[model samples]
Target: MGFGHIPFDVSHALAGGMLLMSFVLLYQRRVPGLIAALATQGGLLGLAALWQGWAQGAAGLYLTGLIALVAKAVLIPWALSTLVRRLGMHGSVQTALGIGPSMIAGVGLAALALVVALPVAAGGSALAQEDLAVALSVVLLGMLVMIARRNAIGQVVGLMSMENGLILAAVGVQGLPLLIELSTAALLLVLALVAGVFLTGIRERFDSLDVAFLEDHRGERR
Candidate 1:
């Protein structure tokens, strides 16, 4: 009657939801909207982790879900929102690549993820293999988001979204340790702090959050 007793289909569905959010992150343009999407993605990641914990009979993964929900869904987004408000960065997101090209690249990355993960996970259950593929696709898409964006906030969103994908992948593996889960959460927390400091410094120096501005400033440094 516990987590392992539940059907694998449910877990697969939850993981799919997480992947959907990753795609959502790719297309968002507004800083606030992007943060909202990230928060939603984090929430979905928590749900996925919860289901994975139950399905794999790993009690510690429940803690992982809790950390994701509290830290990523709630705290990080809240912090980012405050930063956005303070910086007055509610402007349109800047992309290094156009939207059409970015979407095309995302699709290609997803397809490649499936091709790679499926073969690697072939020895496992169908659900596990598919989950791994989905998780990998999400990770790839998150990286694409980072690459496509020229805005510092957008890049931060991409980095955090990619971390969520990594958590998804870790929870999919049965017998993953409690220490590893805690360690991952701690790492994400540090990343958020570092990103905040970095973003604030950028805003202070250039009075803009565009990464291109940083590049221009680098030339001035010499």
Candidate 2:
């Protein structure tokens, strides 16, 4: 199955939805809203994977979709939400770059992604080129989210979102091995666990999840 076999419109719509969620993540200043956007993005990524499997006639991608739904959509969000409640951060406001400037930066990053990915994937099918471009945009936007946030949990969500973009790109590429897909899923799980531990430690040490506090502490020590 070739990339051209997949319907360009449908795949683009799903990828575009994920990209929209990335923007939502950036626009959110509340912790709960950020988590909800992350879950929504995950759901869209799962759908995109399932659609790709059907279009590309790849059974492996169905498993990839299932993994994405379970991990990204359900488990990760649930875990993060629970952790937030436990840490008494459910109502905490996330510190971030001003919404206007962040949005402008996001738009610029999206344009840069399209400019880079389109020419790099010029030899591929139109669907391939578009998906690659969108995936890169999602990745760059995720990085933007991380940079804009001062909350540790928000940074973790940004990291997971970046992984979602990688998975999106992998599913779009026909003939990607199942082993690679499985490994990527496993890596996300491990990352979540590690983030949880680190976040707990940070909270305990600083009495807040704001990373700026860590920087202040470091300066105090210095």
Model 2: which ten-residue window has the lowest total lDDT?
Answer: 1-10
Q: Tell me the TM-score of model 1.
A: 0.93
Per residue, candidate 2 scores C-alpha lDDT tens digits across 1-222 of 244444667788999999999999898888989999999999999999999899889999999988888889999999999999899886656656888999999999999999999999999888889899999999999999999998998899899999889889988999889988888888889999999999999999989898988867787653
Q: Candidate 1, residues 105-219: lDDT per residue as tens digits?
A: 8889999999999999888878778888998998899899999999988999999988888888888877778887788788888988999999999889888888888766667
With a 3 Å backbone cut-off (N, CA, C), the pairs that clash in candidate 1 are: 3-54
Candidate 1: list runs displaced more than 4 Å. Answer: 1-6, 220-222
Best by TM-score: 2
lDDT comparing candidate 2 with the true structure: 0.90
